[model samples]
Target: MFVHLTSAANAPRIRRSGIRAAGRGVRGVHCFPVLPSYTLTHQWVRELARFGTRGGLVAVHFRLDDAEPVTVRHYGTPGERTTAAEAAGRLAAMEDPRGWEVFLPRSVAAPEVHRLRRPPQVAGWRYFPGAHGRRPCQCDGCRVRGEYGGRRLRERLPHPLDGPPPPTRVLLARLAAAGDPGDSAVLLDLLHWFGLRRRRRGPVAELARLAGHPDPQVRRRLVETVWRWSSPGAAELLDRLADDPHAQVREAVADAREWLAETD
Candidate 1:
């Protein structure tokens, strides 16, 4: 059940008896057979191309009666010849549990593998209009700035604010109008992608007004974004930043007033 071998010496010699094996990978192995179903016979697809190689990407998973467990991924061309009527027409099209139908093979010599298969799940509104909002493009700051090409979404915009301005409220108003210290390290990575530890209200009051920022690393990422958004009055602004003269902004405002008095 749930097998996914890519090639670890063409695995498959388990004749049931509580077959086990769990997980292994860099190319395959994952078993679990208390039986009740089974049938990958024909000596398991002639021992899966003797541990697949030429372009590697193999797979397998079994179960036929007690059902559920059927995967397939071999790519062919190593010593090609995977017949038995092409492994029973790819095990009857991976026993139709909605498997087998993978396309994306066209290749103009790998045009970035078709943008690595339609990635860019949006960040900084890649092609705007709330980049199709409703937390569209599966926001996590639009999938980590949609893994490059938008280069951390044009360095988390708001530089001089012209285009792209909807990602988590224009990167929390350009980290409260970043005034320097290299734009406060891109406004502390746009307040660590706006999940400023479960944010409470608009970028934790613009990181508590950048804890009187002058740039002690933007007042230590504004007392670590108010000890990770424990925001509401963050212990009365870390008791007026424990008289900061920058001993690392008074030890990050006495560690955000001892982590908001140990989480109150």
Candidate 2:
């Protein structure tokens, strides 16, 4: 499951920005692009229930940096329940389990997925002060003199490509069997792009597993990808790479380790 941390104002926009292989699915109830059905009231508690019933991948996009932090319940498969604090403690203890799940439309072959709806004209102004509502006042920055004509903005997933989501193992195998250096580079680039779009820890974790690739260049590139994703195990991965045999790989690892240390 993916957990995106963003401001409440931007949450709607972020939700609408579907991944590159865009597909349509409703959030929470029937996720198209795999976003959770969110509720401000008892938000975390509801998530726990959904996780139990849905029994698949889940994404929890929360705007929890408010004065009152959002409550989170221990999410589990069917028949398990726990307090929010307990759940938080458990999640915290676990290696950062990236909640984001990647799905390629053609690979997943979800017929239900459709093209994302087009956003309304001037919908971008919704966040500006005095940019909305049916009010008559001469604010210096009034985009709408009266009621806004634009349709209400809601999160939308991208149109799905035809097919089932590809298996991760298959993708990894393809990477291993890349026909040539160029093919391998392209595959790596695609996976890296996918990881960025999903914004989770799993892809980085998987990439870390390939750190021992015979190619120094590949290992060096992997360091940058891991650094960019900045997932839970990034520090550990860098620590392991600190003694890479190749000078270039070791240099990248050193830089990444320094960055992690400085940030921490």
Candidate 3:
């Protein structure tokens, strides 16, 4: 089981459709695995509210299968691989789990919802735990740019090293279109970027060319792209990827097929 904290305003929609991503760009939902400490489980509630939740907040408790894969980590640190049950137990044993979180890379179905309950009105820390009376980091990398006071904070605490930002989408597309057979790094980035949005057009024809790419990883990403793609060519592409020789690629094909079926 896990608990997702969000604005109470979103509760109705969540109840109706379970807890799906708010936008196509959202990677997935972030929640803390249900810990023995209810406060620890709902630790993100207060921090989330600091960003301006219109109607306070609510907690959505849902369950995941033990064997389900998830990424667990402390805030601003790299995550480690773990199963859902392992993640829950690991956090449950911690003395302080304020900054630790579990990232579930998919939507939670309504049937998996255990309860929607109001947590303690004042639970969890405001900033990083153990960070009282210290100057909050003002670097662009440290502060959330779109939060409630983001603009004011950026103006107030500008960093000298934070130079002009690059146009991310344009450069990603440029690099992706270059199609260097050896540029697996850029291909991975482009594949992940494609997964961030739903495109019912254009992508299939372009990505289909990668079906014969030597890298099994590229073909695996191709399968994943088809998993969420809603086009005439998606099924045909999946059928082509269905025979990938690499075990991981074949496994990804299977998972993508399941996602497509569920979404369909």
Candidate 4:
């Protein structure tokens, strides 16, 4: 058995015409091969809600031949080729299966539709799986323009590589406040922000202070933060950190030199 979660509005039309593939290469339905845990089988309900489809969500149960061609992967990762039956077994063994999805290469016929019923609304993730407590990203690319409060939320936040850089004054104030308290995590985050947007000016003077901090992690973060730091003193700071007593900090200094070399 396999399941596809979609809007209730899609149900009647789907039953009459069958689930059709839309778009280019690797066209077909994105689904889950049924698992022993019922919630696990239809885990996409909550994420699907963000699309604002009419009449809420439903799970359409269907099946394809065991040997049918298919591909499976976690979101944002490349897919792997396998047969329908083998794909189910592969996903069943994943330690954390939350973000994985399966793709059937061909259309699901109307006759293959087995069951249609409501899927529990809260069964899956809202943005991405494992995102429950992390800060929500508010980048322009991530904003759903018509979503409730979407326009009101202009608060910028960091992602691994995206989102607007926070204001310099805000980051500087937080860094100054956290320095005395030795709040390593907050300091690391702020340093990382400096790493991404080097104004090539005043921030490097402030960044110089953290080079001698007790925590090697903080020093490593400083190395990462200053790669594009254009201040004349940057070379001296890198040299000082390159010989840091902690091996991990020294290792970071080694890697950061490559980035500095490229950018220079």
Candidate 5:
């Protein structure tokens, strides 16, 4: 289970568990504040120890990415510092003085203690929500920006993008054109819709025909779409993309080729 320090009251609960804070602002190190027991329980620390016992590492990630503290600023008393995983591993080894510090990202919010199921990557994670601010922020012209409709300044930005792609036939026809550079823009938009349905094999032959389109952007999109399709012809199409003029397209082709080589 993931716990969210959404308010000032909850922040101390996390701190009392032996978590400490260092550095200024959100850029410093913070601990997950979990303690271990030999036996397992529903409690988060016991859960963390159980996970760490299985060769997983634990770390406390914050919700906000910036230097500002979304909840209570101070975490706990000063102590030996290291990342959550490192601390969890040390504790799991049955070491004394069970505590360590985790470095908070300078500009990214990562707010959770999750199991690193895979080696070198914290793959499995649970996210917690922070409480909304009661009043408008005053720092760095935040209030002024809000007065002018800061985040939502654009009228139709959300509605249109969240909605559907315009039309398929129109986009496909525009993409089929021989050498018109301007048509590539329309195709790029269409790719967004098609890209989402990557699980389904759709119109592979028509897309493959444009593999040699002069515009590298269109060809890049084609390479991505072809990678998703599990068609028998996918290998041959990707082979052609291997020699694409654009460095990016060739890189995508290299990835696809490696995937095929591994899967086959």
Candidate 6:
């Protein structure tokens, strides 16, 4: 989420300028002011993207120094047809001296899943944002167990019909066996969870292989996951990844090295 926090003294002037700019009757323009040291949280970013769908430009002015202030302009476009290349070009043109950046929301194309038009005998899995409890068993193995355990116990359970989704575990195994870059983001999240769980098998080896993935994002995530795990040979592998051509990969490797050193 992006917050606009300007100094009280400059707020009036910024507001007046904003009003005058609005009066100009621009087809697609939105303007606001943000302060230094302000954070743009993930939730707010999602909200901003949702609110800025009117296919216009929104400017975010910021105070960088007493004499020079920075201005960032955000352009919101309609529909899901905008390409990343186009968005990058638009961002490049709005280069503001005051550390301004432009953001465009891009749609993610996910794999299609075929679901029955009518509900099946057994309901499929559904993910809730923050729900946690003793849900009903839904996995193949868990469903069998539930059948033997009795319907009364299953009905009284506080959890959903499906047990905890093990997409991470299943995907990690697939990545390890197949090395599919398509599952990189899911693998990264799984690796992070694995690191936290202190699991030293399966996904760790897959993540190690991904250190050399062609996708920079995948390689970067691998570096972070490896470092977070702090597995025995992770540092040595990261040393080679540190020299990766992609800036994101290099940065992740450097951060991992620093974290390792601090821990040691």
Residues 139-212 of candidate 6 have per-residue lDDT tens digits of 33334432334456555654442344455567566556654555667666565455444354334555666766
Question: How much is the lDDT of residue 128 in candidate 3?
Answer: 78
Q: Tens-digit lDDT track for model 4 on 1-264?
A: 899888898999998988988645457899998898877776788887877878988899998889988999998899999998899999998887898999887888999999898877878777888888987786544757577556455544444555667888988888878856467888888877776575765467777888878888899888877755668888788899999999998898888776666656
Cα lDDT, all candidates:
0.42, 0.42, 0.77, 0.81, 0.47, 0.42
Q: lDDT by residue for model 2 over 1-264, one digit each (tens)?
A: 223221234334334543223323412221211123332111222323322322222233322112222223222322223332443444445443223111222221222223322221222122322325744333223322233332221112222331234566766666667644435476565455444344435455656656777777777777766765557887688777878889998899878667767668
lDDT of 1 at 141: 40
TM-score of 3: 0.52
lDDT (Cα, 0-100) at 253 in candidate 4: 83
Question: If both were scored by TM-score, which would come out higher, candidate 1 or candidate 3?
Answer: 3
Best by TM-score: 4
lDDT of 3 by residue, 1-264 (tens): 889988888888888889985434336778888777777777777788777776788999998999998889998898898999999888888877789998887888888888898887679887878776786777644777677777776678776545443354664565567665647777766665665454664357767777777888888887876676667788788888888788878899888767666677
Cα lDDT of model 4 overall? 0.81
- Looking at candidate 6, the ten consecutive residues that score lowest on lDDT are 107-116
C-alpha RMSD by candidate, in order: 18.1, 20.5, 9.4, 9.9, 15.8, 18.1
- What TM-score would each prediction reach against the true structure? 0.21, 0.30, 0.52, 0.58, 0.39, 0.34
Tens-digit per-residue lDDT, 80-142, candidate 1: 223223433554545331212211111112111111111111111222223344432433344
lDDT of 5 at 184: 72
State which candidate has the highest lDDT.
4
Report clashes for each candidate as comma-separated counts. Answer: 0, 20, 0, 0, 9, 12
